[model samples]
Target chain A: METDKIHRWHDMGGQPAGEIKREEHDFALWEKRVDALQVLTSGKGYFTVDGLRRVLEDMGEEAFETMSYYERWVQSVNQNLLEAGVYTIAELAERMEQVQARGETYGECAGSGE
Target chain B: MPHDHHDHSHDTDGLSPSGHPYRPDQDHKLTRWQAMEIAMRELLVEKGIVTAAEITETVEQMDRRSPADGAKVVARAWVDPSFKARLLENGTEAIRELGIEPGVLKLIAVENTARTHNVVVCTLCSCYPRNLLGLPPDWYKQRAYRSRVVKTPRKVLAEFGLELPESTQVRVHDSTADMRYLVVPARPEGTEGLDEAALAELVSRDAMIGVATARHP
Candidate 1:
């Protein structure tokens, strides 16, 4: 069908790959928070699901290989928010720094915000 | 502090009730992505962009959506010819009639027959009908399944332990954009005596995904 020339990295249909891994895990609390952020922000019109998909695709195959599903999603959500001007890089960087200093564990870090 | 009261120490050394290894608890060391999530969420709240209550509500709503919802739809279609017609004609509206919201995406219900089988994949990305079926399984979002399902559906289905006869034609639906698919597996033999609820019990998540058939119970 001559589709090879046009296929992007994320457009993986028909590409040869390894066997499917059947193992599954329940989501972590933080992962659920990431999912919630994606839904809530997009629901509030900060970005569309298309915008989220665009960033995830643009992240390239390396990210697909390395990041867990919600990890990549959180990154994409953050990027979309940046593009939407919900917050600036400076604010994010400073907030991240502050978040890092609060605690070494997610429960500790996430608790201080509320 | 909110999560401090729960005790996860009991499951730390063993598989969870679901028989899968426990995912690391929140007490585990935070990663960079975790930090990013916390920062992003707090920032949005600080700016009054979205309230904390809204995020919690949204997550709860998503948690409420599971394969059982899709199973109910499939079972209803199996028992009622008219509902089956409505579901095949307009999946979103038909599901809505059962009080299940499909969000903004178009839903397409593909019926499996003696000669035709249907399976779905998202070759572009993991575009699942999460509003109807909860989150997709991890395998569905993997590169292998996404890449191979469209090209070699029979082989993929075989991996899922479903072997269709050589005469059966496999139709693969790629969720490339706005549409999502649900496969209504044909009723298993001897299920004629079962009511809707009992039939629903036979519909597993993979069955609706077309990786497997409704189990013979």
Candidate 2:
């Protein structure tokens, strides 16, 4: 508390307004990532069929009797992106960095002292 | 496919670039590692990021091509019933007899039966028998394929132009860590009397998926 009182906190009104805008963008980016990841299987995990099913049961999640939930989600993203001329694997990596950058900027402004 | 070095000493009898038909790199069916490497090399050259000479070290880094190893083993298995039984039992060791590495770990060969066809998919990651089958397909790496294969292999296969008869069974091998799979594709009927080399030619990679049977007369 004493150390906090000693240092001057910068005014962040202008930046905080921009922070809200950045948050919206960050959410949009994450939506795309989730959209991308959900439809497809990067097959990069401890991803076993039984294990996934067990988790669903444990969480009491509704069993979507279709092809595993995220698998089709990922494909839909790919198909959509492909139709849009941007369905390649590179989109995931590119979106991730933008998401992180937006998140950090938002956190910085949100923590700024009044 | 261009062979300018040999052609230089020979004929001037060639026409327009018919010998080298323009084709998409992805359509080339080159191994993913090779394709990716070639793409990277071309990109670097185009961007002037690396000189052409600097690419030499990266060029020779390929380990092997596709399942020429598995094909040899399958061909031998066709000729030798004992070997077929052994292959059905232990694929890695059986494949090793043909002097083909079955990859670094234990490999499993699941037979695609007449009643039911099986396909393998590693839902979590791009886990594959790189030493056996070489690099996997780009579509294989897509989360779409990995996610749905176990839960909806038949449906997925249908999309890939595979159809199963109503009487046929469809068991999906959800490949996980410590295990890898290759489909011990059923031998086609018409090619029964063929020699091992001829049989090997018919044992195409897609046959391993139990999708399209090997090309035969």
Candidate 3:
């Protein structure tokens, strides 16, 4: 039996009054890449669009509300990849460490590539 | 290993800001999640699960789509009654006729009228019609929009500078699961002479999302 684990603000029933901020669709370079990565993975049959939705739906209400749009996409991709056994959590954590270390010394080792 | 392997310690209690907060200073750097995604993507390509060319090609394909596609479709519907009827009946089919593929997800066109207004929201996640409208704007993905829009449709719309009459029923469409919704706002008056392309110019992305109406001539 499937259950709704997380209770999000959007999950609330009935009407409430509030403000909505409006902005242009100016995607940062990383955001654009993440969007493309999502569609590409889905297109490659690595995961279905529905699969991504399930990951998003499973997120805690707080995380869902607080994270930016592409952040949510990144979370979904990470969850999907792990579920698909493309990479292990230990492997991902180690890789993150490596990247962080590289990023720290990138300025000295090589130009920041500005 | 069991699925619980990935469920290792993640501090969900940490309030990473109260809402959808974007970093303007770190524009050049990638977020932690973005870096993870990059690492995973590279690993996948390294493992021969997918290819860089495939991802690049897909990105190019997505880039080709923009609000202009939706604008063109909306503009044509304003001038041609039969096309409007088709759009209302079958969004995917209607869009396909215009050479714009609606992609895998189903698109349902909701028409806004004097008596009723329509808006789209995905409470669970941001499931937009990217095949036609390109990427969703920053605000649409925020907690402020997602959490509020579904609950207070009229109030939220009002905040966006769209106030409805007391009698008008504001219908908020929660885009769940497979189907996506696109709101076809009622054409504004005083532009009967405008051609299709000219009429398209009047349709903004906000109008298609039902936050505002078409710009009047």
Candidate 4:
């Protein structure tokens, strides 16, 4: 009877999986920036860590398999920020367009243009 | 463009300034998510919610926290019985004695003895004590580690080269919610004369995660 309960994709305890890949990589600048943004925004009471996790879980299993760690985090953080009314979706879309128009590379787009 | 005037001749064979191999981010084409990150950060700063300096400071603070902090606590517990007792009783408060702020994390320090071994995993997501022991490792966030660690801890531990005896019990702690786990692995033998600082050297990140025992020095 306990097995009949509907299990969510995010609740992945005791699931069958492959061998653990023992590789490790250093955090990229963009990844670290995403992490920093989450910490700063959460600390300022915009959203809790649980709020972020909720959005991440709602993203579905396809996202988990396709997107990288920070990619999902950026999406979750953006969703939480939008839900909190930190900024409008239109404003975010405009900003993202401006960022993409800056250059083809991350270093070119991420600068403050000082 | 801001980068137009900068010199591009300082080559380090694709390594970043921190000596790690550069992730394909800066030189590679901008991704949708990277654009989103830059956009969101800029928007937040423009709206006066968080300053650029504060974001930088937060990243620096997180970077400063490492397994070394957890190692110090384990080392102290190895040397002081009262501290060990206090740590097992109340991990959050006991860690504060060493000046480590766990923030709102409800830490539960699990001890490994001759009869029992403890391991930790976050089945839902990667909920680690980043305040005390830095970010969770790459494997820790992977599906294999999260899914199988709870179901077959012995097989998982064996994958990490830790072969426990049949008599010893393996207790897997699932960090499904707020409470985080820190495994205080049994100290290695023949190190009774070592001081706390020296003892700290033997405690690696894997040991504290319960995937492997503390390194023998």
Candidate 5:
């Protein structure tokens, strides 16, 4: 039994458009920023729109099906940054740890002008 | 494009421990990618590729866009026959006449008729006409919507409180590329005297998405 038969993204092909529950929610502050971040970076020529789309399309099945739309975009932007050698993996990990250790949310830390 | 090598073995589907989806127990917080996005923005600014002010300006730019813009376009199409002809022919060019930049995306305005209804979806990665319409609704980007909207549009339209007559043919436009779509909803009955602004008020984002018709005034 081949358990993982088809990729979730590929499986979306030709599926009937059906009655999906319409549940709209306000976007989180960070979510809104992520949208802008993608646009800003792309606007600066760090990556093309098609390149960003390709990055999104190439996301793994598990992540694709599970992560929220903007989450995927954030990840895509990160991947693009790393690929462009903006910073090394070690630096990214170190910064992430520093951000986590602040004991306050991103909003708080950024609000304090840190 | 370099692939994301980051591991995501702990990604949850916003499910509760009891197995219900969209549980409210999950408080509003930044997901890992969101945190990373903030970090990336800082890094990009540090690299001199883009400035914080630029990012702020871009955020403001995106914030300024809303469905109200699309409603105005649809409303004008409903009242002005010449505008409607132009919108149906070249959506990108037509929208520019109203000071709206169609941008890089190829926008195609599909008309809804007594016999035909149109809905737009991008099965691949939530490709939407963000220039014409602001950021898509949350539901539009979900896997359930991206997957189902193409195959069972009639059922989906009904879910949006829009049940078309059996004689009305539903057409689902799969936006597979740079070409984005906007469904010009049919002008509702009994509003022949409404001004463009009043008519625009009747058109909702759902109507322009072809999920529902304009509300009767």
Candidate 6:
């Protein structure tokens, strides 16, 4: 579920993700996490696979198959992070702590040596 | 400073006696277009074109793969004569042996010395060695840094607190469409007893930019 305005962003990409009516649901929170509008406004987000696929299609890069949309999205997002001037040793330490917590809460990470 | 798009050559502008922009073509030069591009990027961010969190996540992901330890690699080469030759012949592989990835990053290490100098700038769309350096500094992308770093390298380096000798060659690296540059600054004096981390401490960000030399700790 997404707000009407946020839904419009997905719709504008030419292929909306079904009818997402505004409701207090987990998808609403996920929508917030994956909101392209939010990423764009932040001046520091990357493109998503589904989201990037639509953007690539919009930019006529539909043939690009070298890397997944996820990888592409990550690249731009990393650039924005640097552009935002937020990487210091202390800040990085805190971020690592978050990852450590995420590993504990969620399933084992890709390289956590489960 | 508002500058005419055309006639960027410093010679014609009557600023420098040399026909070239204060920095050479290889050196990074900051111009109005670059500034506008930065502004546009910021605007896109504000308009939800991208987000900060995503970038941070990407960085965390990449850090595990290819870490940036350019200082360590360069310092090793400076001390070891054989490795220096190996580095010159094959930069990517030599650095990769240290666990820095060549697959994800495109790096060009230029040696800086009394006779030869190397300066770097991401001239076209800010193409950088992301895997190696994490994220480039704001100054690396700034038009002022890009343009001046190449065109008027000596002056720009001075601003960054670097003063080179008159005879020292100032080779400005314009990171145009292709690759990102890392300057292998010559070893400083009184650093013989220092360890790798101590040497790295002297390797300032500006030193990598090629405007300044690494200081001895």
| Model 5 per-residue lDDT tens digits across residues A23-63 | 66555557777888778777667777777777887886787
- Local distance difference test, candidate 3: 0.74
TM-score of each: 0.93, 0.49, 0.80, 0.92, 0.85, 0.49
lDDT of 6 by residue, B1-217 (tens): 5977575553465333322232221123322222222333333444554444553454344443222366677777777878777777777777777666665345678888779878776543355665555445444543355444555767767776778888988887666433567788889988889877777777765676676788767
lDDT tens readout by residue for model 3, B1-217: 5545354335332212323233452334545765675666667677887787876676677767778989999998999999999999999899998998887778899998999999988765676877768878767766677777877778788888999999989888888668888889888889889999999999888899999998998
Candidate 4 lDDT tens digits, A1-114: 354237798888887789999876678878989999998999899999889999999999899999889999999999999999999999999999999999899989998722
Best-matching candidate per DockQ = 1
Candidate 1 achieves a global lDDT of 0.89
Candidate 6: interface RMSD equals: 23.4
**Per-model root-mean-square deviation over C-alphas:** 4.9, 19.4, 10.9, 5.7, 9.3, 20.0
lDDT of 2 at B195: 92
What count of clashes does model 1 give? 0
- By TM-score, the best candidate is 1
Pick out the ten consecutive residues of candidate 5 chain A with the lowest summed lDDT.
Answer: A105-114
Q: Write the per-residue lDDT of candidate 2 for residues A1-114, one digit (tens) a residue.
A: 232343222111111111001000111112223322321222322133334333433332132323333333333433333333432347444433433343333223112111
Q: What are the runs in model 3 whose C-alpha is more than 4 Å off?
A: A1-18, A23-25, A104-114, B1-30
Task: State the displacement of the C-alpha of residue B36, model 3, in Å, after optimal TM-score superposition.
Answer: 1.1
Please give, for residues A1-114, the per-residue lDDT of candidate 1 as tens digits: 455767889989998789999987777778888999988888889899889989998998899998898989998999999999999999999999998899888888887554
lDDT: worst 10-residue window of model 4 chain B: B2-11
In model 6, where do residues sit more than 4 Å from their true spots?
A1-114, B1-57, B62-68
Model 6 CA RMSD to the hidden true structure, in angstroms:
20.0
Docking class of 6: incorrect
Q: Would candidate 3 be rated incorrect, acceptable, medium or high by CAPRI criteria?
A: acceptable
